[model samples]
Target: MNKQVMCEQCHKKVASAWVTKIEGSEVTKFSLCEDCLKAFSLKISINSQNLPLDSYFNCLNDKEFYPERLSNFKMCPKCQLSFADFMQTGLLGCPNCYQFFGQQLRPLLEEMHGSLEYKGKIPVWAPVTYVLNTELKALKNELFSLISQENYEAAALIRDKINTVKEKLTKA
Candidate 1:
């Protein structure tokens, strides 16, 4: 947890010398957190108040029963994510659960169109990937619904199957 670093400019003892990505290697730049970072001229912004460009902010606190704090949501009571908002915009507040929430996102995609995939990993409409994705979407929706309905057995089975598919996806 504890790390020791020196400032690049003054060689002074620093605690968090930033990770400066160089041409090849990720060189740690020993610089003043503020001044050193500016000196490096890396594309970074500090104290950035600009909202997420995904437009998720508009619906941030729109949900009537949303928890006041992130501790409330299973992920974070303060998650404050709006399923309705995500459905309308097809965007997310943060990319945090964008992957993990795939199952939950399926219904929205279905309502929007007959398909769940907005974009493809391989190509616009690769038949194999499309088939596999359709299967994955069905399983994901089933898992989410089962869990919500308290059908533990079905949910567990679907969960295992999803894990298998996820593993295959990772390899691919």
Candidate 2:
């Protein structure tokens, strides 16, 4: 019996099929398992339609993928999933993994998504009170800061603004 060949993309699983392409005189060949093939996001054009592959197979195209080189190595307590595991699988082991590996994941998330915090659009149909409520929260915080700094004049001004906003909300 022949030994099984590991996938070219992810070294963890055995490769089952071969993907090949020829352009001009150059020929390219790669081996991938079904799971990795499914995870690869490279879309194929067939009959003018695009087919989306699995997104789970990240880092398949990057030959130098290595999370072990990080200065701090953190692991999830619940699933024993290491940061390296997340790098390889592109998935967190469990829900608690977020809390456990948040420090490390923050940078990765920011790099991939452009920001760590979700800045989703507010619904167009949202109530006018929603905007007033947000403004009131900010004004209240400013009032607290002014009072703490002993600026009674500014604090009173903010206090009056807060009262006006409250009255408006109550009326609405």
Candidate 3:
């Protein structure tokens, strides 16, 4: 009888598929269940270039791989779509999904994109909002210092400045 093998990442599920790579006679294998496999995207560096895991697993379209029927209540209030649905479909229901599933998606995003924070340049049109955000941040820091020093009057002034900047940002 063949022994049962569980997925290495989420050990609660049985291993259904695997990925293997061979380099210079050294072999590495990763076993995963269907759910884990759907969210198992990764980026690896080869010859100073980053490569996506999808390129290696592209054969799935030619081979046998089907999503399982799973359901969960963890859903986005704005879209009414569950996290399980996202895992199965690999698509978010709405923009609110980024906030709702942030904790779960951060690792997947970091693995696929190399970082969670955007490193690109800001848009020229958004400079006003950007400046307001920077000003609001500085004012909040000043407010904190004033509060720590027991200067409530100065803290109130900084607080009003922060609120004004926030209002401008929201209106922008």
In model 3, state the lDDT of residue 69. 22
lDDT per residue (tens digit) for residues 35-122 in model 2: 8788766665555765564432244334465644542344454665668777888988778988888878888999987888786555
lDDT (tens digit, per residue) of candidate 3 on 82-154? 7788888999988888888887788889998788889556554667878788778779889999999999998
Error of 1 at 123 (Å): 15
Report the error of model 2 at residue 22, Å.
Answer: 45
Question: What's every prediction's RMSD, in angstroms?
Answer: 18.1, 14.7, 16.2
Compose the digit string of candidate 1's lDDT tens values, residues 54-118: 23323444665354432223231124344555545666766664654566766656876768756
| Ten-residue region with minimum lDDT total, candidate 2 | 54-63
Give the CA lDDT, 0 to 100, for residue 44 in model 3. 55
Ranking by TM-score: 2, 3, 1
The 0-to-1 C-alpha lDDT of every candidate, in the order given, reads 0.57, 0.75, 0.74
lDDT measured at residue 48 in model 1 versus the true structure, 0 to 100:
71
